[model samples]
Target: MRRKSIQNWRRSNSPVLKRFCASIGKSLGLPNQVADYWDTMLGGKSSSTDYFENYLLSEIDSPIVIGLDHVEVIFQYPEIASNFFCLLRTWNEKAKYGNSLSQVWEKLRLVVVYLTEVYMPLMIHHSSFNVGLSIGLPEFSRNQVQDLVQRYGFNWDSDQIKQLMSLVGGHPYLLQTALYHIWQQDFLLEELLAKYTINVRIYSEYLSEQLSNLRQYPELYAAFTQVTNSPTPVELEWEQALQLQTMGLVHVRGDRVLPSCNLYRQYFNVSASHLQEFHPKSGRAEG
Candidate 1:
């Protein structure tokens, strides 16, 4: 996970500030004054709420939309993440509840994108984050996949498309990668499927890292191995199952866990006998 500090967001916004300052300087003929005070006015430590109101909203003539992606990075640092979220909640509340700062705070619209749900770690009340629009991205439907393939100029029959889906289970990333290779390298669907059954170079690093992470927690690794080797779905601890699901390597069906796709099954289906050999030395040391 990227351990970016909160200052990173402020740093990114610096360029926007500079541009705005330049325009203000040109209009008012005070470039020297603006340059001298810009650092003092914007750089000092303050509540995120104050920063949003005084700087972001005050400078812009129209509504300001702020988007933060991969917020999951903060999950590793729970206290910071919780405090940051609370600060956002405070900003949102000030807008909705009509505080003295609400006039400016209302101009700020925050769009946060994270891999997992924030409630899993957020310290504030659930209503804080729930008040805003929440959109859940769903996997692509069969028609969507077919349309994507057609756009790539692959005139595959239904059976071929089904074969590809069976291997990738309609996963957007895997399907896109497969289609990219087919379109760019002229690889046949059969050739791609065969490579996937053995070892897919495109997914090698990701697969390795996932496996390495699994080794860090023996229970998760054991659950993964059990599910991969089982012909039928197997039950795992709810948290373990969730961890696997979060990794996009397993799917939870009612009370059982199953490999997310045939590709995962083929690649991660390590038998108990192979566990010792496959375990990472770093994981062993930590253990």
Candidate 2:
């Protein structure tokens, strides 16, 4: 089971073909048959990505959705990232163009989710992803937030609800976290907001991780810094806007970019302050 996990399969430096084959074989109740073929295939120099493509083409008979969450993790490993994305792009193209393997390939639909546009770094061909459906999930609306509040059995008044929305901007994760903490721990609503100024520990770790990611990408961090300092939406490079959107850190409207919600604005204000303190000369007022 340990060897069968996808993370282990991708990260392991050891040969994955045999382990992958063994794992899937057991799941499909064809361990011996898969092992026999893997033994033979391992002797060749065929690319693992190509081999996986062929395996999918041969194995899939019905509709299947291959969901990949937090795909940004792969971006850290560029060689594997590029090949895997290109492989997915090719599979999609094959499905669209009708090839020898299109019959099975067409049955496979890839759903890649990430906090940043992984394709930016890979420079994937536009035709690959452009033809497929791209759905951007929206933030929770007022009614949705109300529904959640009611379900949580919180007797929050309209004013309280409005305040919460004003602070978090109906962001699903933040709203849920705020509500959960309020309901479970019996924390005062006013106190929570006041505490946010001093601590922001509720979202500290998540914000820290996001800030850490931004630190690795200096240009992206600079764009975010501009967004944070501004009282209104600011224009940014298309790639920068997309990066912020994917990270759930900002809302993009036409050419303007704004911090997704007040939660981000408050936390990132501190981040921006710290960045300026350490590298004051590097700070800019605008993007």
Candidate 3:
């Protein structure tokens, strides 16, 4: 049960995830086809909210999960809000009977799921970027994460955690983004002392690398200068931002685009200005 709690919503082994497979199957109306359908879903590797809505939430003649209706509540349709709450109320009741599919279907399972989605992100919010980075690198282990946090003091809040989890779901890129900021801030040096700091050295080394990558990827770097030098800064397309984002040099925040982290921001601006000052003679892009 303890192991189950930590491993919630995480079922890699076929035999191990049998129960979760069974539960999801029950929710979908085909208790026996749980494993079969699950295998197919994973094999296809499709990521569509519509697929989840159809596979996990469509009206079915089977036991419902605890929070299905809450998804509906947040579903963003005014007409569906009342209907979703009513569906949720029924699911809550159906879960209460002596034969309550949910009550004994797995308490540990419920807790595991709660930890997997809700609690994990909440805990991650206040933690160090290295901690979040470690979480992403090591697949998904709740206790390992717990130990990581306890070993190195970190913090989290309810909302930021959830927002990040949903955005990246602990994927390496997104997790790294959040952590990059956190860790970068701590190691960063002010402009005066930064020249002597090892972090600056490392970042300067990294900036050099970015400079090298730009030689082969002019399309990506084109937008960086294009924005600052433009009479009216042009809107960058997603494809144009790939190189910048992948190298951790910049990020897109809504309509506004900026550097990936403060450290990068400082380094990028300083180096760019420096390049303008010295590039042989002409400080103009080659026509």
Clashes of each: 0, 0, 3
For 42-161, candidate 3 gives per-residue lDDT tens digits of 432222222333345443544343432123112223332333234323333333432323433222111111111111111122221111112212232344433433343446444444
Q: Identify the candidate with maximal TM-score.
A: 2
Candidate number with greatest lDDT = 2
Greater-lDDT candidate between 1 and 2: 2
RMSD of 3: 15.8
* TM, every model: 0.70, 0.76, 0.31
Point out the higher-scoring one by TM-score: 1 or 2.
2
- Candidate 1: where are CA atoms >4 Å away? 1-46, 54-60, 116-131, 196-198, 212-218, 270-275, 278-287
Superposed on all Cα atoms, model 1 deviates from the true structure by an RMSD in Å of 6.4
Question: Which residues of candidate 3, in runs, are more than 4 Å off?
Answer: 1-198, 225-234, 280-287
- What local distance difference test score does each model get? 0.65, 0.68, 0.39
Tens digit of per-residue lDDT, candidate 1, span 1-287: 13344345345655433433344345433332334444554442233334445554566666666677776666555545565666666666666676776777777677877764221333333634576777867667789999999999989889988888888877787788889888887577888777653345776766676676666567777788889889999999887787777667788999999988887787776434455465655233233
